[model samples]
Target: MSETTWPWGAGTATGIGSLPGTDVAEAQRIVLGELPDLPHLPELPDRGPGADLIGRTGGLLVELPVELYAARWRIAPRPGKDLRRARDLMERDLDQLAEQAEEYAGPVKVQAAGPFTLAASLELPIGGRLLRDPGAVRDLAGSLGEGLRGHVAAVDRRLPHATVLLQLDEPSLPAVLAGRVPTESGFGTHRAVESEVARALLHGVIEAAGVPTVVHCCAADVPLELIRTAGAVGVALDLALVTDLDPLGEAIDAGLGLLAGAAPALPPPAGRAPTSAQVADRVRRVWDQLGFSRRRLAEQVVVTPACGLAGADPAYVRAVLAACRDAGRRLAEE
Candidate 1:
């Protein structure tokens, strides 16, 4: 990607959407205060049903509506109370973000579940998961694309000074690709999706988003090449979970930026948080192992926590965000 097109600048750091709190206002304050350069809209799943990853994204669908059925989000014929609550939660978060960041003019991120993850998680109206029905999957993808386009526009309108960046969370993508997503009965798994199909659907959503997009999958064996081929400007994943470095190296070489999750998301043992140096070292080692130039590290790499901090203690959440920010600055200095 060209310098002008890349959303993140050197020494930029950001969160992976969710934070540890039920208060959206407080979460926004922490995010804006810590990651001012690349603050993401806070996702507070603790707020209940509609605030979760799947339910939240479901609310964004253009025409497709979803409702909570038997504790699982299912496709519904029409918008219901559950769907309304989800949309309302999202709207409130945007309002808080716009209020807090009225004067900010840098890159701001907003996250939603990716097409594959939503397909794997959401249930079909008739039965089983949307993943089982090819036609439903296609419809869901198209709906999600349109939904994301509107979402981006809404964020742009709210934060006119900020460059809105979209991050698609695809934590279940590896399972969907590997046929590991279990069926509703739990007796068998859904059929694996072809790489070409996955790439095409992902590409459509990226185009629809109409922003500099990043795909975040913190699972092991992240399909780096596929994501890059699908037109993502960046890939976000936990560096610790990466068992293979070759694909990562190849993707970086292919001009895809890296949102490197170097700081641990969970609280450390004995409450010993890693210093900024420790967090920076984690990413530096990866770059050295990949044999990438140090000069490109600051520009091509962004430091972040290993994953969402929603499960973490509030104090730990603040520490991790600070560590990531300082780590990014450290990389720039080096």
Candidate 2:
């Protein structure tokens, strides 16, 4: 593990990027209020097309431009309406943050689709998914790196006192590694990307991001070793979905921080929501199972929801964020 200062400091609790609703102002206010320790710039996918992950991230590329075609994001020769719409949405969100976070001084986060996930999702200029061509994938990663550099710069320009953390969302990584991504025609699967190449590209992006980087993959089989190899200081994953502990134990022992998604993002079936004790209990169980000391939990682990709360209703989102904040406090007390 890298022995650098963590941007979130201790007892940090945060959300996984996207929040529910289209009102950027309300989302920013709630996130900043609830997750004061490690608030993230909210992503409102409900804004439709360009606000979704692929199209949203595609807007950040330095020279690369993409357009929505045939229900997929495809490379375009020049910036088009779709690209402009995405950038406009992002800029407006940044403005909302700047307005809402006045005089605030704490760690803030911004997320972008990581390289492999982007490659797996984006279509090449020639029609195939970018993952099909290794050279094209490399080029895309480089472009994304540059794009992310600009993204971080933009966030810094807004939240000047905020120690910004970069979260690289890689939900499709496991599918990419397993060669399960659909081919152009949607009938076949692409060949699995080599782990070495994948790790190297991730490393490049982490370096380019120029902030304390965290790799978030809410997949059951999170590649902890690969994430560590890629120079990510933290590994963010859904603790409940994880069945094995050997690799996680090893990573924690190696000093890699865990952005443990211990709380549920979705709403409850009954009247009351999950208590902070319940959330802390889940994390405590995992720590005990890993044979880790309880005292180090607060500093080494950050409490968060299982994943993005984009699909949840506004009320549920607020409750979940508040629960996460309480969970972090409970973990510290534990």
Candidate 3:
């Protein structure tokens, strides 16, 4: 997508959703302060149960209620305590976001588990994984799509001046495509899904959201082409995990914005942090290696940590976010 059509501006920086603490207000403050150009709603998995990625996203489903059963999220017959708790936690987070960003304008992101990742994580009512039943997976995708439409609308209502961007996290997509997802009995694996099916489902959700969408897959061998075909305006992944640069270069050349995870999400050795120039150089090197123009880096790339900071030290979290923000500015200045 062109810079004019995209939600984020040149040299913008953003996080990959989750943070380490349970203080929603504090997290929102930090995100807004650090990433003024493209702040995201902070997800605090530290809150337990319904606050985690799957549970929180599952709570948003239109009709398919989910509950924590046997230590995993499972489709429930109806709305229950677990589902209610998850939705409540999300509502509280949104309230905090509204309060903190009352006057903030620009692109703000809201995230969720993508259709394939949810399929791999959520269990069926009858005991097997939702991935095992194709029909049920389709139904789940539809529900998620409709749910995301409502979610985008809700965010827009709360932050009236901000343009909402949807991010779909698909950490399990590589496993799903490789047929590595374990069966319910743990004795076998589910069948691999075709790329076309995955693309179609993802496209459905993106279209339903009615906003610019980015697909984040931090794992190795990220399906860059598939994500681009699935209609994501951008692809977010760890730059370190990318062993093959040709696909990345191709994707960028095709006008796909890159959320480059060039900074380390984990704490640096001896508690020392890298400078902004050092962080920005990572993307510059990649651009040079790909033979792309330096000018395009500012327009097509966003600096971020390699992944979520949910497990990083709190001090390191702040440092990393600052590094990302400064790095973006460095890229822009170049």
Candidate 4:
């Protein structure tokens, strides 16, 4: 856990997805200048297609893309070389990011798409169905776990000065397990049981990363209990979509950290960017509803926007992160 109770921070996403043409160092400094409490590393998605914000979080699965669909994932194994070219590319990026993160003095978070989401997004070659083969899913999970261990180490090596937090982005988990993934012809889907096998797959990756991990799902009806059971130290969710806080309340009591998305990711109608006082007020309201005192609230909460600011204007994105930091500070002091 961070020394501060309410460790305010924003997601890796910023207005400009990637830091390509602009100065990466300047971009990170600009973000830190606004929120010094819990500044996460910036994700520069403009780098390329493979470097998409969701894929570059250092938790990529090797060989699964081909297993899913040789033509679709565009994966190929180059011969005569022990390591693949993509792995080399990853190491280069990691080296640069680690060197750049030296300017920030707080813990930095690295984000990645979780296993379920990956399986759903990718496709199978023959029929276009994603790893429907149980064997394929297991292979993907193990490979991802192996990859994450190395990725974590690489980040730590690059930014030894900062505490690295791994964030598993799993917006598709619930739907996938419910067998909601549409068939190629939109006629069929598979329904996975909640506790039986789904939980174990999620748990394996968390255990492999072996670092302080946080699971983030911007969708509504977040499975709070399952996430906590997956051994995640923290869970980030959109407060607006949360219809039930009972499970979250229990998770909090058990010491699971909460990155509560208080403000909307989209621009507000015309109000000033929510102030620390105003944000704290909202926290107070939520706490009162949950029957938890303000003191306890600080220990279990982290103020943030309802979701990533990827779609928001650049100016609004910066403002949101700044607002979140201020709110967290105010609540912590209270």
Q: Tell me how candidate 4 scores on lDDT.
A: 0.64
lDDT of 1 at 118: 98
Per-residue CA lDDT of model 2 for 76-98, tens digit only, reads 99999999999999999888888
Q: Give the lowest summed-lDDT range of ten residues in model 2.
A: 1-10
lDDT for model 1, please.
0.93
Give the distance in Å from residue 119's predicted Cα in candidate 3 to where it truly belongs: 0.2
Candidate 3: regions farther than 4 A off: 1-4
Task: Score candidate 2 by TM-score against the native.
Answer: 0.96
- Looking at model 2, residue 284 earns an lDDT score of 84
Residue pairs with backbone atoms closer than 3 Å in model 4 (clashes):
17-45, 18-44, 18-45, 68-123, 68-124, 179-190
lDDT of each: 0.93, 0.87, 0.91, 0.64
Collision count of model 4: 6
TM-score of 1: 0.98
Rank by TM-score (best first):
1, 3, 2, 4
TM values, all candidates: 0.98, 0.96, 0.98, 0.83
| Clash number for each model | 0, 0, 0, 6
Per-residue C-alpha lDDT of model 1 across residues 1-334, encoded as one tens digit per residue: 3443478889889999898779999999999999978999999999999999999999999889999999999999999999999999999999998898988898999999999999999999897999999889989999999999999999999989889889999999999999999998999999999999999999999998899899999899799999999999999999999888999998998899999999888887878668899999999999999998786898899899999999998888898899999999999987
TM-score of 3: 0.98
Clashing pairs in 3: none
lDDT of 3 at 30: 94
Writing each residue's lDDT as its tens digit, candidate 3 over 1-334 gives 3444566888889999999989999999999989999999999999999999999999999899999998899999999999999999999999999999978889999999999999999999988889999999999999999999999998988999999989999999999999999997889999999999989988998998899999999899899999999899999999999999999999988988899999888876777666778889998898899998777888888999999999887788888899999999988888
- Per lDDT, the best of the predicted structures is 1
